[model samples]
Target: MTLEWFKSSYSTADEPACVEVSWRKSSYSTADGPECVEVAPTPSAVHVRDSKNPDGPQLTVAPTAWVGFIRGTTE
Candidate 1:
């Protein structure tokens, strides 16, 4: 399934410097913070980019790798 792009939860309304992600969440909620990595997930991989430069280069990794990263970070 193709997920829609959404602003990160760490982003605030006043700041144009935001990160957008394709997280499988129900609402288009933005977080309260500044620059962070943005993530967009696809069927095969997860796309990651620097929030400061949306038009810049992105890094793509397998979904499994992404999951492992998340797990590693949280634990």
Candidate 2:
């Protein structure tokens, strides 16, 4: 399955001439080049989605569930 990617909004340019910033996120690349995903967290849940498909469906989970998943992966 193809993972849709998204870019972080924190990127910026110092030069006034440069108006556009390239996509950058916690991403990895296949032989096919760079792919990314962005996460937005809320008080109640964490939201995840493909950057390339912003209008598409998102995966949301409770904050506790998210913490458990992270701890599980790290342990």
Candidate 3:
């Protein structure tokens, strides 16, 4: 199935800079702010784009790969 794109709730409309995340409700979303790097809602696969540049191309990747990337970057 094709996933629909969405913005991350964690993002603030106030901030000029926002990072779009592929959001999955409940699992990723919460009563609090949503996760970062919003992608199209779908299965394990995630499609990510920059909210700063809506017209920019997206990066598609598996959940594990995404996790590894974040882990690597933060480390």
Candidate 4:
């Protein structure tokens, strides 16, 4: 999958550094289906959003928390 970086628009003068995130579609996702999910992983956290609605609300979790979640699901 190609890496696509997006800059967060929530940056302000006080926090001039904008967050750049690279999102990737889940391997289980299909091109012609509705079960689309994407995840962006940074050093500190992981960001998740629905690929069907790119501009919709997103869910962010800490790196360790994300690991636990993945492990839980796989087992």
lDDT of each: 0.71, 0.58, 0.59, 0.82
Query: After best superposition, candidate 2 residue 31: deviation in angstroms?
Result: 12
Tell me the tens digit of each residue's lDDT in model 3 across 1-75.
245556666678787655554443334444455443445634666667654444578788997887787699899
Candidate 4 lDDT by residue in tens digits, 5-60: 66678777787768777788887888787677899887777889998888999999
Q: Is 1 or 4 the stronger prediction by TM-score?
A: 4
Error of 1 at 23 (Å): 7.3
lDDT of 2 by residue, 1-75 (tens): 122344434445653342222222445634455555656666666776766665688788987887888799799
The runs of at least 3 residues in candidate 2 whose Cα sits more than 4 Å from the true structure, single-residue gaps closed, are 1-24, 27-34
Question: TM-score of model 4 relative to the true fold?
Answer: 0.69
TM-scores of all models?
0.57, 0.51, 0.42, 0.69
**Candidate 3 Cα lDDT to native:** 0.59
Clashes of each: 4, 3, 8, 0
Point out where model 4 deviates above 4 Å.
1-19
- Which candidate number would show the highest TM-score if scored against the true structure? 4
Question: Which pairs clash in model 2?
Answer: 5-51, 5-52, 6-51
Decoy 2 TM-score against native:
0.51
lDDT of 1 at 61: 100
Among residues 3 or more apart in sequence or in different chains, the pairs in candidate 3 whose N, CA or C atoms overlap within 3 Å are 20-37, 20-38, 21-37, 21-38, 21-39, 22-37, 22-38, 22-39
| 28: Cα error in model 3, Å | 19
RMSD of each: 10.7, 9.3, 12.0, 4.7
